[model samples]
Target: MSHDAIVLCRLDELVEGQALGFDPLGTGKDSVFALRHGGEVRVYRNSCPHLEVRLEYRKDRFLSVDGSQIICYAHGARFLPDSGLCVYGPCLGQSLSALRWHAEADWLVLEAGQLEACAP
Candidate 1:
């Protein structure tokens, strides 16, 4: 139940119904993005399952117009906001990769050790 965690951001920074991208490794590209949905924060790897490409059309633009679904700009796939499940386009039935995280106080923390284990 103990691990070294890295704070992604203050919870308030994650605006409701909007996507916020994070470059955890300082790679000059976003490795993941977070969204606030139904009073919860959901974090997902930025990659599109169809082609393994980053999903955003531009910085932090992961959701469709009106912010209802996750849109993979590279492949035109649509995913359920809460579940990351691709429901349309080429990768239908495939899901975006979710990262392990939990909110602590006013911050969102990625469970770091597990993330290291999962990193390529």
Candidate 2:
């Protein structure tokens, strides 16, 4: 991993179509999650655009039953996995704030500076 990046998880640890949440700064609420879909990884802030609530209904439960979209159980918002675009619920046309990350040898690392800029 790069010296300046915050390692989130190993690339091999993420299962396809699943989301994993993390608190890179050790903050309890301003968390982010990563989804691996169709063999690619996408990351987003956990907050729901409509209400500023966490997207998962339960721990790491961010994807819809079919694993085709990211679902915010707070109000039933659904977002496109690849783009974080909300396609359903109150936040339609809005998007989840994406976090910048890159794959290293066997890990996923969040851009260190970007994490600070995203602080609430």
Candidate 3:
């Protein structure tokens, strides 16, 4: 079977210690986000575990002030960038949904079917 190819962004476009969100499905809201931490790229669903709300306060604003943690502005929950662990806040002991992806040349990508399986 074949699936539509989806490219989130270019590897070089990802600044270390920052998160970039994408709406690959055109859901009008970002469905997932990716960030570079410790020289590796990690991706996770954009929703917070506490209330299923988008994790950013504004576009590409998923990190805390220091860029050390992912912050869900809705409830002030903080998460570890590498593991999506809700280290502090209402969702403590829980984690954001993670997505597995692979990079192709300069693009960070996923197949349409892969994202569809991860969608709600």
Model 3: per-residue Cα lDDT over 88-108, one tens digit each: 999998999888777888888
Residue 65, candidate 2: Cα error in Å is: 1.5
> Per-prediction RMSD in angstroms?
2.1, 1.6, 2.0
Residue 80 local lDDT, model 1: 92
Model 2 lDDT tens row, 1-120 = 566799998988888978888888887754888888999999898889997888888788999988899998979999999999999999999999998888878889888887774556
Q: Sort by lDDT, best first.
A: 3, 2, 1
lDDT of 1 by residue, 1-120 (tens): 345787889989998789999877667888888998887789998888897888998999999888899999887899998999999999989998899898788888997765542343
Q: After superposition, how far is residue 64 of candidate 2 from its true place, in Å?
A: 0.8
Q: Each candidate's lDDT (Cα)?
A: 0.85, 0.86, 0.87
Model 1 lowest lDDT segment of ten? 111-120
Lowest lDDT 10-residue stretch of candidate 2: 111-120
Residue pairs with backbone overlap in model 3: none
